[model samples]
Target: MFKKGLLTGVLLFGLFFGAGNLIFPPNIGVLSGDYFIYAISGFIVSAVGLATFTLIVSLFTGKGYQELMSDLIHPKFALVYLVALYLTIGPLFAIPRTATTSFSIGIEPVLANEYKGIGLSVFAIIYFAFTYWLAVSPTKLLDRIGKVLTPLFAGMIVLIIILGLQQLPHSPMNVASIDYSGAGKAFGSGVLEGYNTLDALAAVAFSVVAMDTLKTFEFKTQKDYKRTILFAGVSVASLFSVLYVGLALLGNYFKLPDTFKGNVGTYILSEMTQRVFGPSAQVFLAVMVIVTCLTTTVGLVVSISKFFNTIYTKFTYITYVRLFCLLGFMISNFGLDTIISLAVPVLLVLYPITIVIALLVCLHQLVTLSKVGIRLTMGIVTILSFLQVLSTINGFHYFKTVISLIPYHDIGVPWLLPAVVGVALAIILPYQKITKFKNNAEEKK
Candidate 1:
């Protein structure tokens, strides 16, 4: 039982970590400057905290994200929600991000200025082509990404930080990056950046994979089944916290000169690795990025394609894989900065909606929540998220003004107070829906 539990934990770690997740911590670390402590704290809360909560929702409920969400909300709504979720984390954003991030951090530093554009173009095509092959083919090599490469990649970050601190002169922490000078702003920025990782949202969509894998094992009892899953969830959270904090801490040590190039987060790790381990680390980083990102990209494409195929069997898995890889290839050439800039706002909107659902779902499991509360809370969240998006646009001061009326609106999550009211109304109102848990009695079997 113990061995199986630990093994499940290890497996979960691999599934959770990816090249796409590796960038944010160090970047937040760099940008938050002197306020890094507060920044990292907020980051871990949203990134690690919410993702762990998501897994628990899956385990305790005994329904994968889709099953549980479909029961609570409407199936059609869950389907639409999932489609947006998958695309944002799949071909349109994350799949392409894996390529651009790998190239910018791992490969671009070695290329001459004249060749960088062509270099990125060539790298993206080759990256997605390999992703397409791996998604459809499915190899033992892909398994190594989770079991082997993930550990090595994580260890490399730890090793670089330890070695660099000992060998390299530390740059004194100075002014915070543009908007991060204030502690509140830094922490809020960190929270928003945490949304960028998409781990929390992915946790729900990817819960199917984890729960399915757990089901394959024979546990002596229901307790054992739950224990094994808890082991997996806790282990992944621990690993993520250690890596994210370490990466963020290391970010403070890099001296950003006027000549510093590329994305801040990507550059910190790449530059730090180069300084600590020298030119050889560059080759290793590039190869690791390509291999790991390829595996990550393929996994995303496969998951996304499979879900779409499941919904509409008219398209074969291979066809969807090819389509997405082609899309990812075309989009990745827009570069890392462009990909991130567009993706963050979309994430900001999606994350809170998911978080509210996860929160209400967890709360409901403890004690039944009324449909009114659930519906009201979700409704307020959706409207607030829309306003949050509009408020960020060029000609939307009124949207900003409406959101400003909400307390704590300045700290990035303008939805909190309204969401609280919606939850409060649920408790006050007596409209109980007697919602059934899709897996309550039958899950253990």
Candidate 2:
């Protein structure tokens, strides 16, 4: 039981604490300054809310997130969700960011000034090479690296927190214009920033891995499985809350240079290392960043490969892994900034839809609706979400001038109102008898 719990903690932390996680809170802290508490609260709502929803989905369905969603909705909806999830988590966005960010923070500083780009290219080549290698091999190496790196990351983070606190008195007061504004804006921005971490999405992906881990322990009874999952969930939530809070506070206290714009994780680590450790701090930080990033890249590769293999049994794992890694590497060459800019609009659309589905799954018993009702609600949500995403990308003004005025401009259109309306419609809509029978049976007990 103890080992099982520890494994759960390890897996959850490994999934949650990726390179983006390291960067976001500190950036929020620096921007938020005195408003740090409110900002962190909002960030926690998205991060922890997603995590909690993921745990609930894993426990009740006893299937992978994709499988559960597909069962609840149509198979076509499941395919769209899976493709969006992959693009969100893999080659198009998150995976490439992993390689690029790691190189920027981990390798660039140590090289001769002229050689930095060349150095980055070389390191990225090697990093993804190893990513591809382990991805194809499918061994214990990925897990071993995760076990080693997660503890080191936790320790390094703790050290950073302590150093920042020690230097707080000497740091200047909050001077940014954004910080002068009310806490609500700061908090809302922070929440949006935290969404960039995509840990919540990763949590859903990793739950299948966690379930497999439980099965290996011979958790024969339903009670044992539930206890194990709950234990794991608590462990992950506790660790994430502590670390996220600590990092945000660290960022809040430090008065950094104006040059430290964008790439928050890299900026914080570089600045803090310089202050705390002097010139040599750069080299130390670079090494730590590389290792942490590499561990994440490898784990993602392995997990994604495993997922694809399950879905596409005919294709060899090696073939799929290599193809995906190569695609990820090609995409990484485009650099981090571009990927992030493109991802935001898409994530804005997809996150609400995913959350709605997960929430419905969790409240399935209370829903007491036919499958047709559920499908109709889901369809409505998806359509509205796509419209919002399009409007965001095409510019809000264009949308306003061309399309009918959406009611909720303050919180953005196609969000809470559409979702609520969909739910109400589902409740009120009539459905065929066959669809109602199974849904009623499942909800009753």
Candidate 3:
């Protein structure tokens, strides 16, 4: 049980610790400056909140997130959720960002400007090709690689924290707004930015994988499974909190130049490593980033492939796995920046819906909400989410105007108020009871 729980925790950590996450918090620290403490507190709340919520839902369902959603609604709705999740986590967004960020942070600095693009292309091809091979086999090689890379990533991150702390007293005063005009608004913005990590969403998506790990270890009882998941969640939460604090502190101390602007988190790490560690810092950082990113890519590809394989049993699992890898590679070569910009709108649409679903699943009993009620609420929310996403992506002035007139943005989060209202209505609505009186009346016929 101990071994199984530990392994599950490691895998969960790997899934949650993507390249973008590594880059974001530090940047938040840098931006928040003197406001670093407030921002970090808010960031930790969202980060931990999402993880805890998903863990609770997964534990109760004893099923994958998709299966849980299917129970609440229909199989078709579940399928839609799965597709959106795969697209968001796989080729369209997170997967590509891993490869691109790895190259940019880890490898690009060491190369001459002229060859960097070509170098990144070549590295990506090799990276995805290797990812494809492991994903198809799912063998001991991938396991060994994960075991090796996990420690190395942790060590490098720790080294970064140590270096940043050593420089803190020597660092300049925070010029950026630490105490903004509105405390509530500042905290809320920080919390929202933390949501960009999407660890919680990934937790739901990866919970099945975690559960399977438990089953593999011969955990036959429900009690054992619950304990294992709770342990895993606690372990992941601890690790994330420590790392976030470290990175946030690093960002808080470093005063970046104007050119060092835009997602300054990655730059802070890169520059700090260069300053303290010397010329080899680039290589060290690159290797760590590449390894971390590669592991993430392989995991995502495998998960998505498994999902598709279940729906279409005609194709061998290996075949589908290879297909996902190839497709991901094709999309990733376009560059990371492009992939992220394109994915933002989609994420906006899906994230709110996903959050609402997870919340509903957790609160179903108290809400006395029927499957029909859940579906109705989700349907209404999804439509509004779709419009918000469209407006965001296309810069549609008219859509924005329409959204503003709605109760939420005209009132916050277009679907939030509507979902609450829908839930209230569900609880209040009366239905005829299927009682002994009714049964007796039918029997009289």
How many steric clashes does model 1 contain? 0
Residue ranges of candidate 2 with Cα displaced over 4 Å: 136-146, 170-172, 175-180, 259-262, 365-368, 394-414, 424-430, 433-445
> Over the stretch 1-445, how does candidate 2's per-residue lDDT look in tens digits?
6557667666667656677877777777777767777778878877776865676576556777676676577657877787778667877788888888887776666778899767767777787888886556544642665467677777776786777678776342555346325576666666667677787777666676666666667776777767777777777777778888877776777777666556766777777778887877877777667666666676667767777787778987787778777877788777677778888877776777777777666655455555666776777677766666666554566654432465543233345666677666656666641231143346567
* Residue 112, model 1, lDDT: 99
Q: What is the lDDT of residue 94 in candidate 1?
A: 87
What lDDT tens digits, residue by residue, belong to model 3 across residues 1-445?
A: 5556666777767766877678877777766755666677777777776766776677666667776676666668889888888878887778878888888788777799899878878888888888887677654422644466666787788887887679676442456553332445446556666666766667665766666556556767878877777777777787888988887777777777766544576688788788777878887788777877777777777777778788888998888777777677667778766876787677667767877877777776344555556677888889988887766545587887878777645213677788887666555655521221122335368
Compute the lDDT for candidate 3.
0.71
Model 3 residue 380 lDDT? 86
- Which stretches in model 3 have alpha-carbon errors above 4 Å? 1-3, 139-146, 170-181, 365-368, 391-395, 401-414, 426-445
Candidate 2 lDDT at 313 equals: 87
TM-score of every candidate = 0.92, 0.88, 0.87
Q: Between the candidate structures 1 and 3, which one is better when assessed by lDDT?
A: 1
Least lDDT summed over 10 consecutive residues: which range in candidate 3?
432-441
State the displacement of the C-alpha of residue 384, model 2, in Å, after optimal TM-score superposition.
3.2
